[model samples]
Target: MSPQRLRDDLVKQTKIDVLTADQAKDNEAHMHTVSRSFLTDTITVPTPEMMSYAALSSLGDAVYHEAATDALEKHMARLTGKEAALFLPSGTMSNQIAIRTHLTQPPHSIVCDARTHIHKYEAGGAAFHSQAAVIPIHPANGHHITLEEIIHNADLTSDIHFALTKLIVLENTLNGTIFPQDEILRIAKFAKENDLKLHLDGARIWHVAAELAIPLEELVSPFDSVSICFSKGLGAPIGTCLMGPAAFINKARWLRKLFGGGMRQTGFLSASAAYAVSNNFEKLFHVHELTRRIEKGLIELGAEILSPAETCMVFYDPAPLGLEYAEILERAAKLPDPITLGGSRLVCHIQTSDQAVADFLALISQLKEEKKAEGWVPPEKTHVNGNGVIRDVYVRPKAIH
Candidate 1:
């Protein structure tokens, strides 16, 4: 289907009236109990009937090793136009396996936008796995690296006195804008000429593919390797896939095992992943439209919306800080506190609806309109203990002045 059509139809919205008042209340009540950390992404576990084809594949725990991997390999290879593909436990593992396989040449380096997930998160696994330097390029605002930026930094004079840029990675729908094909093509051409491997961190590749109206295969064929996560917007509970030449995939499989990713019967996760790829993806395109709705809603309220919501993420910095960060942190740290859901760092996903959006807006509105006469009790109100100051007594809840 055309990306535009998919976007229009896949996220086809149900009218607010279709939901009974009780159902709406139930959803909000559910959200109250749900942890905000889990709400930060679209990867909530599915319900029992969420596309589970028990008749076709009843072995819940079976990883469908031969079948699932074969399906995964074929799916990835067809999508990437690569010779082979393999599955890993997580996107982290998938990217790690690919990097380890390609960075065989010592002193090899990867060039990426500094805002990449691999750099910020993952707890430094790249160094432990590959022992290679990851050179940071123009990494900002989700760090999208451009072609000219590459040509400007690349060493055409000689390979020595520089980390051989073995890999160049680009993320799509990066900071909510898909890279124009010309840019991707230019980088691919640059990589080819410089003997560099082009890897695509296509965790959310569907957004780019759906936005550009290009089949993923056509868009990703130039990449030497690609890592796609099923658990992100794809809505799967777990699993990630890496695509590349058959030889490269064979090497990745072995490394996956070495990383303790080899599972006895992971079909449970794979099954869930397969179901997510087919059914959940249609919902992702709709998120784009929903984001537009939120952006417009926030803007109309006279709030300075930081930037328009493109995909599922929309961040807005609240003004005149209704509450301090430290207070929010301390309050949030209290175990089982439902107020954490009201954190400034809001996120949206499939479970969220228009009414829920309204409630969140209302919550934020209430938070901002109120005033406080004082901050948290200073150390002056507390007594010093051996290692820490102790509150002498509970400071009465400051009345909203």
Candidate 2:
């Protein structure tokens, strides 16, 4: 089926009520969104109070300004213990810029886990922008790559036949589990020994540091460059920061412009990112706790917990309960305040409340019980059948690059 036709079928079959941001805000009490990675509509959309604050703050200039853009960069650099930082439009840009900056000249390669955002989700951007190849290593558990795996894939031999391994990239909270610090340190040591640059896709690093109860700087110390998302788990509407050495960041700035990421009067956005750094950073712990609560509820419902609840994400397979993906999704759409299926991943963030979690679980329980009573058999072939049993859902709001 065509994409638009499929969407039409879903809406018609489920009678799902899709709400705009304004509509969601108006219906906040009824809305329960467990799949969003940041604050829900109520917090994400600016309020009159927020507008008033922004009015008092310094306005951004046509070019990157000292007060807003520069200050945010410096603040992120300080927090991550890097010599410099550059604020970019998105995490993808930051990661790609780091790739371009590190690889410099082509015929280069970057080694990363098969599931890293750069390899899986970024639309082959490293190849397109940096003219570099990606060497993906799949870990047995599908969560994180081991140091041994990196060693196996590094392929640092000086053979002209192979792309020179210029960088090793790792991700924190790759599948909602914190990438172990010892492993990171080992990889860093190996990268140093082999003269390869190290970059970290720390998009949700805030959750990792909060869960580890460690300072953010400590977690980022091993990598030569780190990209952090203010928009994910941090509750900022948009913005990502890339931190590294001063010279590296200077090059990244030029790359950002080349990538068309330079924005004039961006302080409005930077101010929100600044707000997230100061205010929302610490609230990540509570979000993780809520995720744990949701995980426990799903466990009680006989859903398979695919991974341990570490940060604000919960991954699971709902098939064990004999529930059809379509049926569950359709049921969700029928709720008083409907929630669309977020693939298979449920993510909790600042706006997801304890009550929202409870309500979601209750809905699941109701579906399971109804299925049991009716002896309902899922259709032999359904929309999600070919997609695999395990669902990996990460909520990132769509934003312009």
What lDDT does the true structure give each of the candidates? Answer: 0.64, 0.79
Model 2 has an lDDT value of: 0.79
lDDT of 2 by residue, 1-401 (tens): 89999998888998755776687466554333433222221234443444455556666662556477788888889998999999888989999999999887878899999888899889999999888899999897667899999888876888999998999999997867799899899989989988999999999898988898898899999999999998887767788999999999999888888899887877777888887778777888888889899899999988777676888777666766676556766777777766655545677777666666777788889888887898965434333434476443322332211
Could you give candidate 1's per-residue lDDT for residues 302-350 as a string of tens digits?
A: 3444445757666554433334434544544454533334333345555
Total clashing pairs for each candidate: 6, 0
Could you tell me how far off, in angstroms, the CA of residue 179 lies in candidate 2 after the best superposition? 0.3
Which segments of candidate 1 are over 4 A away from where they belong? 1-39, 54-65, 139-143, 155-160, 175-177, 320-345, 371-401
**TM-score of each candidate?**
0.74, 0.83
The candidate that wins on lDDT is: 2
Model 2: how far residue 138 lies from native, Å: 0.9
Residue 123, candidate 1: Cα error in Å is 1.9
TM-score, candidate 1, is: 0.74
